[model samples]
Target: MANFGRVIELTIDDMIFKMGTYAIEGTIPFDNDPIPNESEIKIWNLSPETIDRIKRGSIVAINAGYRGDVGLILHGFVSKVLTKWDGTDKITTVYVLDTDDISKRKVTDIAYAEGTLASYILRDMAAQLGLPVEQFELNQDFKYEDGYTANGEVTKIISDVAADCGTSAYVNKGKLYIRNLRYGADDVFMLSSGTGLIGSPEPFEDEDFKGFNLKSQLQYRITTASVIDLNCRRFNGRVHVRKGSHKFSATGDFMTEVEAILP
Candidate 1:
């Protein structure tokens, strides 16, 4: 049995991404839950470009291995605060909100990807599990610069939502992310000698880079942001939201609210 010594029960939400046996965790969730300390929440807090790149990276990682199911965001606000065993890691046990909870309103069971070799199989998971745009502190806003033709026609380049626009998510150093993805069935694959199979990007350096796959379809990074913004409405307390789904919503906040979320 798990130890229950001098136990104190507090509630919080959590997220994790599954790529084979490896899982990358996300933030703790709550719509308006209070966090006593600054360390309680750790949104990327990077430059706008970096934030976008992280989002793009997440999109790429999810879609890179997307079979069907969408990635999860275990979003919930802080319910109760604890003062003991407070390690550097910002984590706690959430109440584990369920669909039946009153304040949470609608709750849907996300498939555990029982059959697929990866973690998920439900394609609409991200779309169904996203939060609203209003609550998105992701800093995803974009800025526009203007250029003039020889005749001064005056053209503008939207550095935010265009392909190869170099607006990808930010990572360490000077590298940016390219989170493009596609799910067309006509895709083809090549096998690697040592690693087995990886989606084809370009020719591999060694003979082991056998699985050079390619896709004829394309989708935008913005499309990904919208798709995962669903379920942004559900919060903890009155309603019992699901464990690993979005509860805040930005469905109609497109023009003003969402625009401000960009880098």
Candidate 2:
């Protein structure tokens, strides 16, 4: 079902078969889409540690490991064909080399599918402090309410509800396995029911502290995002993202409804 439009190609060892262990080094997307679509396939999967740079007729670039932070970049193609002449002795065509072009080092790598890849890694760590990735807009919602002060002493007044896309104390832990791609069938994995209860955040605010130390200075925060709400659109393809309006939200199963063969 992957004929998308027709240009599907792949071979830098089949786009490294979705680098499930990282090593993708860099990548960012939003080419604006001219065609192709089958969920646009973000963060497909990767594990061999990646760094091979990619070999054999290389071309590579297929989304990324599951939960793919979702920015964009799942184009495809790479083929010289796995050659072999029946006449034996003079058939050579498997070659692929030069190619690198990529971005994105940490969004906690997807931070377990948390709110748009940690809001694009907190807008790439606030564009490395200089901020202004087109100026203020990576989400900034607020809603607070605090309670507690009468006497029992438990009157908590907590209501700093944020849901736009402009904050993060970056935390991550992922493990997706799924199944039917088959080998037994019940793969499983996909954890994080709040991983034992969201308790492990302390960027800083200490004195003589005894944990995670970066000289005490700290600033990291990504609030919320986790999309694809059309009932998950069959295995995940409706091209989600807009949780709090980071933007981009395509459907029709995220694109391709027939024909797809990109590599």
Candidate 3:
């Protein structure tokens, strides 16, 4: 990607809004946690009718990149919309969550028979929530000998099932995914000076994991659990993304920050 001429397209319900020359600002964050990802976007100066269309619960999809390389970065329901005045500019901010309608719904008195596969239980939970399955990979499909009962919030239930199977479950781009922490997506993104690598990747360590913090020209393709082939002055190898954020603004801020660990 050339990393020139910023392009952003926001789709709200049936209406579409495009911005190339205008200012668009927002932050989109993703991770491997059980909860859905939330995004906050700000657009400057819109008509009253346009603002009216951006009500709560409206479907929203945001795509951005340099000119012709645009791609989907966020897809979810609008959780909130607020408009305010900044001098002569009227800014509208929209909050979105990447989960389906059943995020708040509860599963009551549902039980699975003994010897049931963990994958089947997860699929049924997803079906109940109306969330599509994007990727489901489990290293061990543990079978419950005493059977299983599903209760509480759908998100929690799904998380519990994943824990029993020794995996993690999360929603990405409005779809559900289950995988072990040691694994990630098969596709690899190369990051170097030529491919928008900003500076030397800084090394950090925690109690459980040690990884690098990376900054590069906004790369929309990178997501939670995506593999990165890093080629830099200090470090050169592959790492799996644990969490990251894509941040953009018309005031010269456009980049992707990632915290990744060796897998």
Candidate 4:
């Protein structure tokens, strides 16, 4: 019982709740991928008091794994909640999507001079969504033409520019990160064989031909940030996280799988 207390720490709308067994599914966006990555959480037998706070648009953060503090597996706003009853038990599930979902709705139309720097334009777009810029390394010299219009969803404009520059842009933890494909080597987190890695990393072909030509799939017992390093053969040291899903249950166990690519 004591161990269970240390295994899962969940905060929803700044309020913590004790749950039976829970699971979270997440995916990190890259390239032309959708913004604000999506996640789903299933909680067992939640108290009425806790469920009341989980209205649509509430904030949620999760920390799980046996060693306890595994960092944030998923952070986003609640989209929907479903309640179910299985004979003598009650189950509640919450759906979540990163801030991008909310920001994408805010449409804007702004014109820039022919020589406007890409960084400045990006900053302006992000500001509309109240998201901070993490890195704006898109070619500074790259400029839009005179009478060019920056319009539509704020995230769409940023992503279109990133796609044009052969880079990627996405939102994580309420921050916008723009960088070259597979370029965050200095910040890579090491995943050793003894750690969460389940089996030998499997190689697969990427269905998104435009995104990348190669992909490596990994399964683990937990989920971390959107990016990580698979310290093994054929992974090219670091892989950009494309998608991840975590499924945890009190009676069964916890597991997370990630699909990544090299550049």
Tens digits of lDDT, candidate 4, 54-150: 8998987776555534556556788889989989778787778766474445565688887676767767777777777766666433666553578
Worst 10 residues of 2 by lDDT: 213-222
Query: Which scores better on lDDT, 1 or 2?
Result: 2
Best by TM-score: 3
Put the candidates in TM-score order, highest first: 3, 4, 2, 1
Lowest summed lDDT over 10 consecutive residues: which window, candidate 4?
Answer: 209-218
Residue 138 in candidate 2 has what lDDT?
Answer: 22
> Residue 258 deviation, candidate 2, in Å?
14
Global lDDT of each candidate: 0.20, 0.22, 0.85, 0.60
Models ranked on lDDT = 3, 4, 2, 1
Angstrom error of the Cα, residue 144, model 4: value is 1.9
Q: Per-residue CA lDDT of candidate 1, range 1-263, in tens?
A: 11111111111222232333221222222211111111122221123443223321121111221133222322223332222223543332222221211222222442232223110111122122232212111122222223111111001011122222222221111111223212111122221222121122222223322211111111111222221121111211111111111121112110101110111
Off by over 4 Å in 3: 1-3, 181-185
TM-score of 1: 0.15
Per-model C-alpha RMSD: 23.3, 20.5, 2.0, 4.7
lDDT of 3 by residue, 191-256 (tens): 999998898999999987888999989888888887889999898898888889989886576889
- In TM-score terms, candidate 4 sits at 0.77
Global fold similarity of model 2 (TM-score) = 0.20
| Model 2, span 29-48: residue lDDT tens | 22111111111122222323
